[model samples]
Target: MPLLAFWESNPDEVSQTSIEQIVAMAGDGNLRDGSLCSDELRQYLTQSDTSKLASYVEHCLSNSFAKGGQVLQDLVNELGRRLDFKVANGRYQGTVNAIGFDGIWLSPEGHTIVAEVKTTDAYRIPLDTIASYRRKLLDSAEIAEPSSILVLVGRQDTGELEAQIRGSRHAWDIRVISVDSLLKLIQLKENSDDSETGRKIRSLLTPMEFTRLDSLVDVMFTTATDVEATIIHSAAEKAETSDVITSKETSTTPSGWEFTDATVLDAKRVKAIEALAKQLGTKFIKKSRALYWDSSHETRVACSVSKRYTKGSYPYWYAYHPQWDEFLGEGSRSFFVLGCMDLNFAYAIPLDILRKNLSALNTTTTERSTYWHIHLSETSNGLIALQLPKSSRQLPLDDFRVPLDQS
Candidate 1:
């Protein structure tokens, strides 16, 4: 990856042309007109431990090629391997550079399954190729009914392909599935450890990592469930009763502020928010999953929106919902920010943000570069962070729009 560090740092160097060339070269198994599958390249890679070499292979596949032929085939092979595909030694033609047949499997029940791996954005396998795979599998064993599966990686329009396959008059049966579908099958297998049939059903269901942590934290509040909303509302009510948020300071108290049951922020709403901010014609830095700019009164505006908020915390998920702080390389210039959770009550500022401002500052923690341990009881300057007035004009937190120039 260091070989690409320089180019990746300057996005200008990684043009569409270079990306295409990289993908082609990856499929061709070449670098600098030299074959990476050659003994020399293999020796060089072998100089490092297998794990590092595997990482390097993955990096090259993911970063350089954007995923391609041999790279995709290896992944497909690995998926089959990890799942303990009943058929071992499933190679065909024994091509070098991992360019052999994608995979050939014999399910425990004696059904032969032949798979063809593809990593193109849009590709249509000819009917002849499907026939050839069926013939090959039948020849390899005494199986009566042989089925074929086309495993596509990153191809978005697989539905059309599947339909075409279904309609085709090819001699044998064939099914088209995206790698994502296949992965779902694998995951279901992992989850359903009840019986072999259950696991196989998972395998048959078909299948998929990567995450945007900052974006995830920002959307965390949007996905909060009804139960979670009840808890949050109860917390707010307790604060009000305890005079933490005195009724005298209330401006626009919300009665039932909740969102529909959705865990992910809608993409269209995110675009709308961005477009609105762009209309303001002010430069705003988008970082830490929050939009940051200075308000009219010199107060820093750190605002984020949650289109969906799930009810519970997932593994590696930061807590405190809309006002969550993910010390994982996320920093805040604004002490107390606004959380637009599920676009319910625009004035219903998140308690977590307030808690963050009042709690001990962020410090190093396991999953993040910085993490905060917040408690609502903590306050500053004799002000109860949670009890802050829900005003329309008193502060910049009331509006649902991005604050770019404090307007």
Candidate 2:
């Protein structure tokens, strides 16, 4: 008998025939060239107009539930705003894609608290998926050690959403709520029509479904066993080390310092200043005399000298005192008791109070004792002097180590 006639006679066998045909055709070398003999079956399935089939496929893919993922994402974003939590959705890490929740809260002792969020539907919550999320939480050290809160939401049969608090562990808590409640909250802030619609849809979800969802939420939120803080810390440390190495490799030495002047400018000192500048940018300026930088707004820094200088006696030293008055002004502020040092050493002083303090310093050197000397304000353009030793004075301006200007 012919294959179609035999299959028609034994209807139950027809399914197997189609499967075998597909498998055989798929394995054939000529399959790509459309030479495989599946035209009869293809024509049967496609007997309907192509446009109709396309429309049917599109309709299937565009169902309400299929589109609900975006609604959920929006809800997550809104919740984050209300709770001051950081929320991100559809993030991919390695082969896995997930939503990330981050936030900081104050503990009873004022310590910083952190939290995470996850979601599920009426269907069974997969253990592996929950575990994977927990693993991710454990991997992010900044969020791992802080107290965590997990939130689960469910839709109800009555078309009204409901919420349940699954559990709370020490600083951590697991909570569940319905979309209706969220809508109501939103309604309180805005329009009532949306709230009413939300309430209606929330009513469709059964309580039992929500309860089961709450159980999953509880497990995900309350259970601390899945996440290990130590693991996260270790990972963070390693990552930090790797980042340090990578940074060193990519970083170029600043152009301002030359070799001959390098000795006068302590490599360690310049690096420290550069590091500060890198972090604070132009907000900080290094005081040439004190060998320390000051915030732009700060004026006088408390400095001590081991030996008081007799003003006229050290006439030659006046040139070395650094045009302090040029950089620091009279209106600058002062910090107290920074340290005791010698005339040869520089002290960081605020720009505003420089003149007031300079006037206060005793002109004559007393016993080799600590005394505060006011820095002078000299520069109008808020330039802090970087003093080089006399021998290194001629070094090019490019030899001074300064941070690259990102601005």
Candidate 3:
């Protein structure tokens, strides 16, 4: 069976499988520079969640195998993809004619990073050779001048390698980062809502003079602040109430549902994705906190979860942000999935339909942000509808309800 099929069959053993074990299940039990096994492994990595990727990285770093370094190289490239870079995978092994870089990551702002993966810093690296690869890429116009070399080491204690780079003539053009730090950056990017967070993470890979620590501190502080804000917003959402105008032209304020648990919103959001993934017959890898996409990049979904409000005609409320809209635009087929936690159902609204009704939706604008308010109400006849502005007609959500049961 293929790697994905094998993984599907043995889901529990995937994390425990070593590099060699995974290779044996691929093409001919061998991993070459441009072989079928390499292709299969990379595809699997692209579709894997961050947890699986972290596990595989641990397997690679625990003990060296026949093709362990190559595996690490591919994982690092996938990390680049998660960080919103346009990644071009490099060779597993260097050749005489081609550049010996492991990967090239192109940022949205037009900067480039030439990546090199190392299992450890026991031996000194040939910084000149890595620099020469960058020069060759620049000469051939494969990468522009604003490119720098990144050495990804397995060990967090890279003292020797740090000394070597600091002493070398090419020190200004090369930077070093541990595999642990790289993975942490990926986690931060995956959870962040700020659009500029990815750019700042990419900036950490480039060569920068750290004589003054203000710039570095700014990146860390801003990212942490944004994450904290997201947490606070989620907590505040549970207690917030809004007036829902009924069909009879009467406005009534709803009380927030009394709930003791903190993780229910998160759980419902996860279930929404799981239920949609089964219905679509394809696995979706998370691209961001709210956005997920299939391996083929053809389908994307932005999932938002809402708690049930008490004593109102409309019991569910969701804040749809611009970032989710932008993320859904990256795919050919996209959906804005709203999970009503109490109703135990979600509406996977097509992007085109959502776009058409956006102007008729109610929006809440503040100094920091603006978002459309999505409200779901049930009728006396046991039907759900999307509540729109009083000027527009409400939309029935029964047809757009995502499949919640396996059958």
Q: Which predicted model would earn the best TM-score?
A: 3
TM-score of 1: 0.34
- Order of all candidates by lDDT, from best down to worst? 3, 1, 2
lDDT per residue (tens digit) for residues 280-361 in model 1: 4322322222333221212223333322222222101112333333221143333333333323322223334454353433
* C-alpha lDDT (0 to 100) for residue 336 of candidate 3: 90
Q: TM-score, each model?
A: 0.34, 0.24, 0.90
* Candidate 2 per-residue C-alpha lDDT over 75-157 given as tens digits, one digit per residue, 9 for 90 to 100: 34334332222333332122334333333333322223232223334444333344345456557653444333333443433
Q: How many times do residue backbones clash in model 3?
A: 0
State the local distance difference test value for candidate 2. 0.31
Q: Which regions of candidate 1 fall more than 4 Å away from where they truly are?
A: 1-67, 87-100, 140-146, 197-407
- All candidates: CA RMSD in angstroms? 16.6, 27.1, 4.9
If both were scored by lDDT, which would come out higher, candidate 2 or candidate 3?
A: 3
How far residue 353's Cα lies from its native spot in candidate 1, in Å, is 56
